[model samples]
Target: MKDEKIVGSFQLMKSLNKSLILNTIRTHGSISRSDIAKETKLTPPTVTNIVNELLEEGLVKEWQTGSSSGGRKPILLKINSSNFYVFGIDISPREIRFAITDLNAQTLLYKTITMKEEMTSSRLFQMIAKQLYIMMDEACIELKKFVGIGIGIHGRIDADEGSSGFAPQLQHRNVPLKKELEKEFRLPVKIENDVRAMAIGENWFGSGVGISNLVCIKISHGVGAGFILNKKLFHGTNGLAGEIGHMFIESSGLKCSCGNDGCLEALVGSEGIKQRTLNKISLGYKTKLIERTNGMIENVNGQLIYEAALEGDLLAKDILEETGRYLGIAIMNIIHLFNPERIIIGGGLAKAKNFILTPIQEVVEQRALTEQAKKTEIVLSKLGDQATVIGAVALVLNEMFSVQYESVS
Candidate 1:
């Protein structure tokens, strides 16, 4: 027992030292073993040993020599961004988007395909494989350089098993997405909730770069949130930590996909906005939407409503203003609960821009605690349509570079 404990301790210490050394090299960019030792506070021998291991693994490479300081010039080290590539895929209810990116999350190829009237798990996986093949062919890169494929699905994901238990948007249950992809592509796979993936992407490559505590709210077919707390994605005990869409917003609101009434999703999601617009029209509200859709109310969607508002349609503008207010209330609730450093609004509705963000900001400022509101910067996602796909890539990169050490592969 004593020997086992000692062995475990030694392994833990070695992993921690390796992580520290790697992080120092990544952050400092062209760094030497002595510089890594100084930044990580690890002994020079430890830094050198770990760096040699990383070099052998091809994760780090020696760069040009640094300036001499009255002695021999030191060799600099940097992360080998081209050593491996990650494929990111975003599966949504209406469309499938995928991209190929380097270890640095720089997108090389991106494509979007609209979903047919109905989709099954088999069809979905086949579509993903087809696009991946096309992307790889276009890039003409060696397959051996591929590290893994990351998938972001619009639903609850079993991270450990890489399966989805329930995806209301997909109307599918218990799909073995990860296993299927790994079998088809013959590569390792990482799967995560779409919004959560976006949050990871933001933290690693986008706006949340230096910020530790942040929230990413996605509003589209449904509402969901992803959190980065204390420099880590906070997955609650049940991995449902960021399901803010179901937060109670109205006591008498319409029914939500989760079978809840008055949930925030029921009030501000894409369907919710469409339902509200239909109700207003039914109640004889005046607007150019009727003429815009040629009197086909069923044809109205969040995008059409936004377009109508842009065209100076009164009802459409009112609908969006109300949607923004509800969204603001949601943001206020997020502020009071998490007190995050930044709140990012994403998804299809994000395109509403000032039409939606303005109202959300106004509500948050007026309703949330002054201190929390002041500290939290609410802004639209900088990634736009690429957020989820980039986030998928981030999932692989994040796991690869995470300092937690225990989960590092």
Candidate 2:
């Protein structure tokens, strides 16, 4: 027992030290071994040993020489970002996106495929596996060079179990995403709620970079949010911490998919916008939406409404402004609760920023409790359409670089 305990302690300490040195090199972009030792507060010998191991593993490489004060120039080190790869997958209600990225999260290849209606769990697995093989063949990188796979999927996720507890869009429950993907690909897999993954992506590589407290809101088929508190993703007790879409806003508003009345999602989701536009059209409001949709009321959609709004259609403008105001209310609630450093808006509705951003800013400016709170930065996602997919890549990178504790067996 004593021998086992000593071995476990050594392993844990060694892992932690390695992570420190690796992260130092990653953050600096190019750093010398001595600098890494200084940054990580590890001994030079320890840094040298770990860095040698990383170089042997193809995780890092020594780069050009650095300027020196008097003695010989020191060799700089950097992540061997291109030597290893990760697969990022985003599964939405309408489509699935696949991307291959390097250690630095730079995308090398990407593809999107439309989702078949009424997809079952088995079908989902097969489709993803097929796409993975296709992308692998296209990249022509050896299988050993690919590190892992990451997935950003909608609905309630049991991240610990690597399964979707319930996916409202697919109407599927308890799908073992990690197990099946790992088995098929013979690689590690990480899965998280799509919105949460978006938040991670933004934090790592987009607008939220360097911002410790941030929130990412996705407004498309539905409204969802991901929270980053104290520089870490905060998953509530049941992994449902950021489900702000169902927050009650109006007592007698439209019915939500969750069987709730006047939820934020029902008020501002894409479906909500479409429904509101239809109601206005039914009330005989004058608008170019009718012309844009070519007299097909069923064809009236968010994009069409945005086009009409751009053409100076008052009714379309009013609907989008109303949507913005509703979103602002929810955002205000978020500000009061989480007080994030910034809030980033992504997904389809974000494309309508010109029409809706003002109303949202107006609401926040008028209602926030303090001057700083009112001035809290709000911006569109820098990652845009690729936010979630890139976030999936971040999942794998985070696990690879962060410290972890494991039981010795």
Candidate 3:
């Protein structure tokens, strides 16, 4: 039950034939050995060998018999989803969330730690390690049961290095997340941008399931996007492919954290929405928001505006509608550029979907080039607040199920 022994056993399961057979069983829910061999194009003996190894390792199990073609029924195999576990971490500007999930990405234990203030990289690392230890002890799961650790963090990420290039909210640079965590836990570690992780998570377990090309937009204190192109997470050169928040939308609009004017995030991100509401208030346009925030303009925020809009407050509704229009413009541009099958919106602002979704649809309808493009699906995230954290878990599951070595013909 030593950590190395566990790691070694997991590593042994990474053979190309093993991954192919395992994924086949996972995908089919339960599949016969002959069917797996046919589906994976592996020889019957190869499939039998790997499946037997998987069963012995407890990664998969033989289920009830499947219908046969006149002969005896064949025993089917399926993933032993609960046999191994993964750790997922979601790091945002204001908080860090931790989750333990089975192989299916179903959360088992979850916890959150709020940040009163920003801390150094070392401090952040210590907090994460301590909390993970507490969670492991609390869950009482054996150390050998853990397969890997995954982290989804904001800002630029050097995934190959498993380090953060710059976490703007945390004000930390070059934080060695993968290196530190793998050293501390003696388990494999994966890291990705928070938004990209959400996209992957959605593709695997949420709304984007079965969609080949998709985009997931997170609109909170800041805006960001994750892109899935051709059924794969597309990380552009320098891993900045989905930084749509900084995408230029207007030259004369408000400033963004990236120190740019009129970026998509500046127009519709939570701060931008709040600032626009405050600007409207400053212009002598009156509404219940003044009293709702107790005449303290600084207390005004996206959620309060949404609540006010729900109550038929014209000013609040108008602000959200305009914000939606801004988001729609950005999404339309995304459609023109990537032409994804669907775009999923998540985060704090998505709660105002009632108000914003209409405007967004309207803008796309009015401006998109082709009729098909105009009808592109735009929906809110099914995973909601847990999207990023679940995506963190997907980072590990993805690795676990993927065929690492290319198969020889």
Which candidate leads in lDDT? 3
Q: Please give the lDDT score at residue 230 for candidate 1.
A: 78
- Kindly give the number of clashing pairs for every candidate: 0, 0, 0
Clashing pairs in 1: none
Preferred candidate (lDDT higher): 2 or 3: 3
Q: Tens digit of lDDT per residue, candidate 3, span 80-114?
A: 99988999999886799999999999889999899
Q: Judge candidate 1 at residue 200 and give its lDDT.
A: 84
Write the candidate numbers in order of decreasing lDDT: 3, 2, 1
TM-score of each: 0.86, 0.90, 0.92
How many times do residue backbones clash in model 1? Answer: 0
lDDT of 1 by residue, 29-112 (tens): 788878777877888887888888888777789987746777767789998877768899998877889898887888888888
In model 2, the worst 10-residue window by lDDT is 1-10
Q: RMSD in angstroms, all models?
A: 5.7, 5.2, 4.1
Off by over 4 Å in 3: 1-9, 66-70, 156-175, 404-409
